[model samples]
Target: MTPHVPALPAMGVVALLRALLKRPRRPLPSALPEIVTEYRLDRLPLDDIARYRAAFGFPGEHIPLTWWYLPAQRAHLAT
Candidate 1:
């Protein structure tokens, strides 16, 4: 069963919108990198996944494909 989660307050939404609007945008590279960048995970982050699922109301039976974005974003920032 999905747990009940509180909705975001109106001020919280306004704050998020303000932050996003004020953030600077980055430009994409003119040319693609000669070598492909790949990210590998030696082990799954089960605890983190569990927390993510609970927060997002995803079922715990399996890992959702969307969870991959977490690692991908981290890898992008690291490089």
Candidate 2:
């Protein structure tokens, strides 16, 4: 069985703006295979980190390991 989660209460216009302001900004993590590629797992040796940064212009540290998902997909397709 799945667990139930509570939803946030509706906020008034002013309150909604305030809530949004208070919310923290989090950088999105890169896809899974990108992470694996960046770390050079297994024998693939794909340069995910460099490619992602070049394509999206993300700062070095903010790049998430998730980016490896692309390479993983390609590997699966090849098989």
Candidate 3:
């Protein structure tokens, strides 16, 4: 059977927060034309835009967002 691991140490939390805080805040990418077009999006299908949006969780979106942090957390937990 696999052994259970404890939660992150206080230092680990602080370090992660520090690293995240240190990252520069930049504008979101503009490659997503549907989300940034200046004119009406009548030509763009809503389903396509929805699909792209579904790929990432927005601030107010109900979709799960923890996967973004899973890799780093897993690495730290492994150590």
Candidate 4:
């Protein structure tokens, strides 16, 4: 014989339906005032640049393709 599965209680089923039908709350706007911050990749410190290059295994003096994300992330966080 197959084992019988228990069903959810009426209250539990109602709560689940209410939860499923509930609308998502809208996100609140930022309270902090906007500020502009300038970022210059060329101005990065020599040591930091050296470390970045070394981490990515770039022997030559050039920024890697993956390094572009740094500036993009900085800009996004600034907003």
User: Which candidate number has the best TM-score?
Assistant: 1
lDDT of each: 0.84, 0.67, 0.55, 0.77
Off by over 4 Å in 2: 1-40, 43-48
- Give the per-residue lDDT of model 1 (tens digit) for 1-79: 9999999766778788998789558877889869677777989988889888988999756897899888888988987
Give the per-residue lDDT of model 3 (tens digit) for 8-73.
Answer: 756678788998789657878868655432323245344544554566644443433454354456
C-alpha lDDT of candidate 4 relative to the true structure: 0.77
Q: Which candidate is the best by lDDT?
A: 1
**Candidates arranged by lDDT, highest first:** 1, 4, 2, 3
How would you order the candidates by TM-score, starting with the best?
1, 4, 2, 3
Looking at candidate 3, the ten consecutive residues that score lowest on lDDT are 35-44
Q: Model 4 off-target regions past 4 Å?
A: 1-42
Lowest lDDT sum, 10 consecutive residues, model 1, at: 19-28
True lDDT of residue 5, candidate 2? 88
> How far off is residue 53 in model 1, in Å?
0.4
Backbone clash tally for model 1? 0
Off by over 4 Å in 3: 1-42, 59-79
- Poorest stretch of ten by lDDT in candidate 4: 39-48
